[model samples]
Target: SVCHANSIRAEQAETFVADRLKEIVQLPEVLPRLVAALNEEIVRQSQPLEQELVVLLERKEELKTKIEKWEAALEDSPELFPMLKDRLDELTEKRRQLHIRENEILGIFQQGEPIQVKDVQRILTSLDRFLAQSEKKQIKALYRTFIEKITFDPNHKEM
Candidate 1:
């Protein structure tokens, strides 16, 4: 009798769960946007590239200021001339390299496209391989556009 009662209770619980699940599934209001967000793909944009370009330009400006200060210091004290000249040369070379890199990033933006799922995954897998230096910000910004929100559905246990 105990076993029979337990079996009946189990069957009732299963039936109740089944009915509740059907009710939740039939409710269209609950699952649309969440499903859309999960299914939607991501695309690349220019904000990230522009962000890096801004940084590079700022660094180049700072380098110019540093070089100018060193030049002024050298004129004030010829005894420190050789060291200051070396530093200015290093700063000038660094600024030149930044200029070259900014141009490269601009080139990448010129060749833009609507990136898909595979492309996003590939970029995520090897961010460094996709871009270099300040362009890492670009990669991060691109990835952010993906999965911007995680909408949970308890009924389906999905995004």
Candidate 2:
């Protein structure tokens, strides 16, 4: 399976990737349709992660409210406040960690920008036919840059 994904089963991934590439790079004629399709796919893939993030955010808010109550109660009992202080610190750290995890989950849904000019050139070159070895290399590198990974299901014989 470590070859050009030219097989019938790979058609879906190929079409999805190619159409998404076209849409992202803004090929005007195919723009709207492909972009909408990619957006739908993105939303579908991100939904579960998004839900998890929402839950985490709600927990964070709950923790914040609890910490505020602890801080307010600190004025009433300086003797008992150390225990509450420690709990507050623990909850604050947990909330911070949760926020970081939420951001990491959200990062999965982000659109990546090419950091190099050559990557852009590679993308543009891949959109056209090229006979030269240099151009071929560029196209090959471009394909790898996207890290086209295919998953195979042995039980069902599908990808």
Model 2 lDDT per residue over 42-152, tens place = 678777888998899999999889878887788778788767778989988998999899889967867532234345546545663332344645645665666557554
- Considering only N, C-alpha and C atoms within 3 Å, which residue pairs clash in candidate 1? none
Tens-place lDDT digits, model 1, residues 32-121: 443444444222346677888999999989998998888888888989977677778889899999989988987876665443445444
Best by TM-score: 2
- What would the TM-score be for candidate 1 when compared with the true structure? 0.41
Segments in model 1 whose C-alpha atoms lie over 4 Å from true places: 1-45, 113-159
**For model 1, how many clashes?**
0
Per-residue lDDT value at 117 in model 1: 45
TM-score, model 2 to reference: 0.53
TM-score of each: 0.41, 0.53
- Per-model clash counts, in order, read 0, 0
Name every residue pair that clashes in candidate 2: none
